[model samples]
Target: MELYFLGTNAGVPTLQRNVTSIALRLLEERRSIWMFDCGEGTQHQVLRSPIRLGKLEKIFITHLHGDHLFGLPGLLSSRGYQGGTSPLTVYGPPGLKAYLDISLAVSQSRIPYKIEIVEHTGGTVFEDEGFKVEAALLEHRIDSYGYRVTEKDSPGSLNTELLKSYGLKPGPIYGKLKKGEDVITDEGVRICAADVVREPKRGRIVTILGDTRPCSGALELSLHADLIVHEATFAHDLAEMAHQYHHSTARQAAELAQEADAGQLLLTHFSSRYSSFEELIPLLEEAELIFPETLLAEEFSAYPIYRRQNGQLGK
Candidate 1:
């Protein structure tokens, strides 16, 4: 899995950053992409990146903030115009359906495919064979939410060499074995899947949070996550201002990640005051002081999550 940062600025757009939008691409696992937010100019950002809009299957909105959802209407329209026939599902807080309904109706937009809008009130929002998504209310001015995505463990691969030795050529039998089935070979030899199958690969967890102050909900969602994408809209010294505005400072985000024992912390939704990389480095440094594996989200940048050779997750 990989993440594409489309926009990273907070509240409003700046010359260097747009707003809050992220794409979690699961092409290898599911051949589909799930977006975290749809800030303004998000479609334009997709055009500039390698992401294909047609592959977008789901979008999760953190809140009803304008900067987080202003681009949804246009994106849906364009997807229809571009011949996206596959159905799309959008999960967000309450009022999301009404907002989209009015926006599309007022613009006279026509979508060719079916769209499912789910306004969840903080619980298990989505679940399928491969993944599950849960939401929790965050401490923001509005009812903002944090999402936790947990991927299901993958089955172990069949031992091809061992199968060959036993005269079991690759075919349907391999598929059955991979599914942990005990099969009797044509020669009347019974083989257990566990004898030839490796250990199951561990699943990954990712937590994405919206605008909010430090809160228990954030910690719950971020617990032991492989990647924690948290907003760091202010510097360490501006903790008061960040709390007053219902946002988190870089230090606070790092502290939360540390408390949660997360593998990595990605800081995004930066304040526009830090316009350049030089100005933002201080915030990154402050976060690194608390969480050494912290990284600043750069617009249009892609971060890939992979398992290391030692059976550990890394980004």
Candidate 2:
């Protein structure tokens, strides 16, 4: 799993950052990509990256803000023009269906693929064999939501050496053994999967928040996550402005990461006032003091997720 930031700015696009959009790359696991918050120019942003528009299987919107979902109509139309045949599912708060309906009707755009929309009310919004996605309401101007993505654990590797020690040769039988099936050989010897396989490996977890102020929902969604992506639309000194605008400051984002015990915190959704991202470093350090692994999200930046080695889960 990996996260590729297409746009990181809040409100509007700037010379340095665009609007809010993120791509969760799951090509290795599911041969598809999931996107969150398709702000303006998101389709254009994806054109510059390696991500394929046809591979976008799921889109989760945080709110109805123009900065968060203004690009959906264009993206959906573009997907049809690009020959996307797979079904797409979109999840968001109420009025999402009306929003899409109005956009498509006004533009006279007809998509060839099936598009399913799920209007959520802050709970477990989606679940499949590989993963589950939950949502919680956040303190924002509108009914905004934060998402928690939990990937299901994968089966462990088969102990080939252990199998060989039991006088079993490597063959299709090994495949059955790895799948936790007990097979009897021609010699009347039964082999159980657990006898030759290690324990299952734990899956990775990632939580991403939309525009909001400091709230318990953010912390609850991000609990013990491998990566927590939160909005930081302002600096710490602009706490009042952040609250007024229903946005979070860099320090507040850091504090949420620390409180949630997240493995890493990535701050994004920067305002257009500052041209230089260096100004947020000191504020990020305040978060780093509590949660050492803190980073400021950058446009087009990719964060790869690797399997944790043994004895590294809690840390």
Per-model C-alpha lDDT, please? 0.92, 0.88
Off by over 4 Å in 2: 188-190, 307-315
Candidate 1, backbone clash total: 0
Against the true structure, candidate 2 reaches a TM-score of: 0.94
User: How far out, in Å, is residue 44 in model 2?
Assistant: 1.3
Per-residue lDDT tens digits for candidate 1, residues 1-315, read 988999999989988889889999999989999999899888888889988888989999999999999999999998887668899999999999999999999999999999999999999999999999999999999999999999998888778999999998888999999988999998999999999999998788889998899999999999988889999999989989998999999999999999998888899998989989789999999999998989999988998765433535553
**Candidate 2 residue lDDT tens string, 1-315:** 899999998888988789999999999889999999999999999889887889999999999999999999999999988879899999999999999999999999989999999999899999999999999999999999999999899888998888777788888998898889998887898888888879988888899998889988998999878889998888778899999999988888888887877778888888888667786676677667777778888788898754445524342
Off by over 4 Å in 1: 186-188, 308-315
Q: Lowest-scoring 10 consecutive residues by lDDT in candidate 1?
A: 306-315
TM-score for each model: 0.95, 0.94
Assess the local accuracy of residue 6 in candidate 2 as a C-alpha lDDT between 0 and 100: 96
**In candidate 2, how many clashes are counted?**
0
